[model samples]
Target: MAQQPRYAQTPTTGGAPAALAPSASSSAATTSTKIGDRAFDKIEKTSAEFFAITYGALVRQMFIDHNERADIVNTQLDQMGERIGVRLIEEYAARSGAPPCRSPAQAADSVAKIGLKMFNPQRPSQWLQPPRSSGPVSSSTGAAIGDAANGSNGGAVYSISFDENPLNVFVELPDALRQTLWYSNVLCGVIRGGLQQVGFVTLVWYVRDVLRGDDVNEIRIQFQGKERETFKVDMQK
Candidate 1:
């Protein structure tokens, strides 16, 4: 029989037991009836163990398909996330009734306030201040990922922290493959793809991961600019 995947057994904060603090305004009652809440309610609740196993299997398959190549796996994971994000944004916008974000800070706030709150245990307190602009920014898939942490459009960076990562519930990474596998990199792609639908171009990636043993799990995101399409036209030579 295959050895069952090992889970980090330590009791940690986060997961489904956490409650969302309702707004204090009188309209709070009305807000409670909003689409996001309704949608969240309709979601099928499942054990983290199950989610972990299922997600793990998917990742394992990808690794196998790619001959356990980490870089390719990471890229594939991000693409998958971006596709999900593209769809998720439409769903979120329609359900939450959130207005279009005007700036990076506003976008980050909505991502934390509505996006994370409804789905995960993260709260607004977990959001870090947007990174300040100083120098040239780095590219996403190149040496820039290791260079200045600034973004493209006016160099604004935003981030959120997660105390408990459901995906990591039953994960035990082999020492040799730890750096090779970015277990949650899909989130970076998701954020990038989701915001792209709303007219924002961004570069998102994990600055930290609990599996890698960082203080609090963090994802650092940068706002690049608006995505544009180019077309070819026939002209007299």
Candidate 2:
């Protein structure tokens, strides 16, 4: 018999997200192109399958085959994240004209309008900025964002929050509950793969949040504080 589809249904979970996301809305008055549950289901299944393959390979390549080495696996994941950063910059440049995203809202717009289109064609983007940035949250022109950055008191402190997670399609996976399942920082891989497909290599990709939860799907890439480096997305606003 042919194997069952991945999303025939969600596997039992500790529990599903408190609320599933609402269907997307369109501002254009004439016509709206939207992907419904069926599309989401397909993405969900593909995500789960990919996670399985990547996680298993990671374990074998890192632990059983050589011996558990945390650093090795982590470096791999981060390299992947940087690759994604590079590819995303290219896409943003093409569609959004490469701005450093003056505000959190703009960042969300970049992810939605550019990132989602290139990565998760089936899903829309939803961005939530983490409090404020330790690195001045102002326009490249150096205009202060005012009181909004008032919360910037954190002072170069590390602030952790979610970024654009296309893999949320795997939210609460089945069977894998309890131990659940995670190919930690696998987003790094996706980012790397997507970027390498094009051409860009500044920083290496990496994953910080692990098997955390669907609530905070965080991922990032860095090259030794090179985030300050000039790039297309960093172009003047």
Candidate 3:
């Protein structure tokens, strides 16, 4: 029997983001109309079934390659993510041309709005991922909108809360490595690595995980410092 689609019955309350008009310089745009349109059009999403298996194999290989050291695996994953981030910024700018974010709150909002839409656009509204930076609040008395919440001191810190991770789709950690493994920790590195290119140095990490039986998955990003000089050099490179 054929399996049901994971997001078939999923609600789509949030409106789709308006496509960023590609500028003349973005050769990638010439190849694909929109950042997500290619994936949306050609590939039949596998309900993440094959993704889980392939990702599981990768983790297993990493374990053998590293001699079963969880710390080394985690660090390796982060470093790999960082390299991806360094390149991702260039692609992101080419596609979106999102201006330099002024504060941590703004950066978090952009990550939730633009980043998710580019990568995980097809997820259901049940995922509670916001369509825009100004998403709905969870409670009537809430102070913030969507998963992007500004901290008490304002721009110094913020959190982007969400329920699903594209990488962690249908993942189940074995009991032997449950406590030691941060299954999706590479994401933290991605955020840190990508943002650093844009001049914002940050501390990014997971606060909760569904793999750990948490109700939600959240990533907290804290402002560290900004380097305009090096940022320009990195962008030029």
Candidate 4:
């Protein structure tokens, strides 16, 4: 699980829930629908453990089911990623120079950087070092996966989590971000869509609860199928 970013801050009055005060707005009904607490409570209730475990398990199950046809699953996932990569390549070409993607690691790093930048501009992601591809990033046999002297590294898989923990979606938002996971997941869908467009057609995509019942806290992805061992990207140190 990734930690949430620093930018997400909830409004506070001396670290306490301030009493509901009438908004300065002169409209009577305007202040009446100012249900700040209600939204937060709903978000809190949504991110509960039940939602996380159930959602996580459902995604995992979907992957296994897709994997029933190992050969097709493998091709399907890579094609999906590739399809996204193709469209992304054109986008990248239009926006920036296109670097040669020669391995799975490279592809992951490229996707992460370009995807994040084209999607979110506020807090961009920094790729971790060691440039190791682990945990099913792709199911390709020839993919480069780092391994220990006595153990095996998981295949190359991209594990994405929010930068902040328990983002308060229902609380008074700071305008940096709105108070809704539903709004945030649009980024996720764009990413998922890009991947599918690139040809990782068999992936299981869904949002996960990071803050118990809040759903505002986290979004997650697990490749239900496979990816192509095509590129080696430099994870920005």
Query: Which one wins on lDDT?
Result: 1
Q: Which of 1 and 4 is the better model by lDDT?
A: 1
TM-score of each: 0.70, 0.41, 0.64, 0.35
Can you list the residue pairs that collide in candidate 1? Answer: none
Candidate 4: lDDT over CA atoms? 0.35
Compared with the true structure, what per-residue lDDT tens digits does model 4 show for residues 1-237?
212212223345554453222224433231112222222222222322333344334333433665433334334444444455445534443443434444344444444444443323212222222224222221122222222111123333443434432222332322222222232333444455555443343232323333334332333333343455233223341
Task: Evaluate all candidate structures by whole-model CA lDDT and list the values in order.
Answer: 0.62, 0.37, 0.56, 0.35
Model 3, 1-237: lDDT tens digits are 211112222233466432232223333322222433433333333434445545556766777788787778878878877887777766666555455566665666566555544545432122122222433334222233234443433435555566656666545666666667777777778888888887887777666666767766666666777777235322332
Better of 2 and 4 by TM-score: 2
**Worst ten-residue run, lDDT, model 3?**
1-10
Error of 4 at 75 (Å): 24
Model 2, 77-172: lDDT tens per residue? 556555665565554454444345443333333343444443443343222222354232211222211211223333111112343343443433
Shift of residue 128 alpha carbon in model 1, Å: 2.0
Q: What is the lDDT of candidate 3?
A: 0.56
Model 2 gets an lDDT of 0.37
Least accurate 10 contiguous residues by lDDT in model 1? 137-146
- Is 1 or 2 the stronger prediction by lDDT? 1
Ranking by lDDT, best first?
1, 3, 2, 4
